[model samples]
Target: MTDSCIQKQLTEPGQEGPVTVSISRQVMPGCETAYEAWISGVIEAASSYPGHQGSNVLRPSASTQNRYVLIYRFDSYENCQNWESSALRGQWLDKLDGLVQGDAEVQRGTGLEFWFELPELPVNKHPSPHKMALVLISVVYVLVISLNLLLAPILVDSGLWLKSAVIVILQVLLMTYLVMPRVTRLLRSWLFK
Candidate 1:
């Protein structure tokens, strides 16, 4: 962790929704095992905190240039901030001394922003709002049309609100776990250009 990282997280107020923090660090030679143990402990500690959704560890890969990425999520920004500023987290950061080559780079994202983030790329800049809106609109339009066609028969007898709710829940789930990730990767060049 860096002073700037801590300062920014402490001073800035985040939006009220799910928030994710990506911590990227390059481990010192031969310190991989220790770094792994440290990360496990910290993640375990984090899971005990309020609003902890879960965490995902991206181990060093060829494309990532051997940098470990720890991505953790909280149900809301306030809870995430609480865990980030906790003494337990500080103690975990203290143990990072000499284990890593440099101060970890941290990136925070909420809502749709995380969809635009590329873990392999360190560039913090996000696609412009118009571009994101365009992509989202295109994807959502297709989803809506396809879903309505597919579910019309099944939901024909259902009330309007119930049918709408089903479509929205499915859309959200598919967008979050399926479509967005693949679409983002496919359009990375244009999106990040």
Candidate 2:
């Protein structure tokens, strides 16, 4: 983790809401299997902690080189910090001495801001508020319009409020799980510029 624990201090402390921490680790050549095993163990250990929501691992791909990006979520910053600062986590990290290369790159964010993170970037940088807002506006517009058009026939007999509720729920789900990640990745260069 290197000085990432220190880096966390650079960001706001005690931030409310779900806290997401992205950890990027470059696995040494031929250590992929061992790293995977280690991941399973650490994830299980982390899951035992209070407020540990879950984790998703983005394995190395051509674009990501050998880096494995682990996204860990907790209910709040306090819980996240507890897990981060735990001796258990330290022990797990210490076991990585020979399994990976260099220190892990870590970035922490609250709520929607995590979507805008660029894992490959060395430093934690967020898109300007205006840029983020613009991209979000565009995404919401497209999603809402497209969803309405596609659902109109099926929801024709539904009441206005019912239809609106459905659309809103679907819109949020798509935005969180599907559309946003891809859009953020695609427009990262412009968004971050």
Candidate 3:
């Protein structure tokens, strides 16, 4: 990767929850096959790391040598860090040596950010409103059932406003860091199509 591409680090602060790291790389003119091999190796290595969730790759367009975007997900920041700091990751990066152009552009965020965009597409290309509503309803149903079961005793002793506030907070946090990511990915075929 080019020096310019290496400017930003993979994970930033507040990324301790379920996180998705996007690595954008410009493959050399004739090294597509080599780059794919490197990606497979990296993914295999990452899958063995603690807290590893899953990964997705956006291949370059058939008509152009565009950048390839690799999205890797992990269950927690500590787990992601362990993979990033490993000698195995370093070796994989080293293996890419001259197969890619400049340094890779890395971005990190909690997984919910991907819910709005169809995987392998530009960020603005969102899923249909109907599909989004379906997903939202499913999530809310799960959250309500879960919260009712887990917080029944606490809610019975709390004021109405306090109960509402606590429930909302829990719903938002759970949806953002856990539920949405897995749901969106699980239903990608229907959500995107």
Best by lDDT: 1
The prediction achieving the highest TM-score against the true structure is: 2
Give, for candidate 3, the lowest lDDT window spanning 10 residues.
116-125
Which ranking of candidates, highest TM-score first? 2, 1, 3
**Candidate 2 clash pair list:** none
Off by over 4 Å in 1: 1-16, 144-170
Cα deviation of 163, candidate 1, in Å: 6.8
What is the C-alpha lDDT profile of model 3 across 25-121, one tens digit per residue?
A: 8999999998999899999999999989889888987522378889888888788898999999998888988899897767776544555543355
- The 0-to-1 C-alpha lDDT of every candidate, in the order given, reads 0.88, 0.86, 0.79
Once all C-alphas are superposed, what RMSD does model 1 give against the true structure? 6.1
Please list the residue runs of candidate 2 whose C-alpha ends up more than 4 Å from where it truly belongs after superposition: 1-15, 152-169
For residue 14, give model 2's deviation from the true position in Å: 5.4
Residue 54 deviation, candidate 2, in Å?
2.7
Q: Residue-wise lDDT of candidate 1 within 66-129, one digit each (tens)?
A: 8999999998889998999999999999999989997788998876777777787765767877
TM-score of each: 0.74, 0.75, 0.55
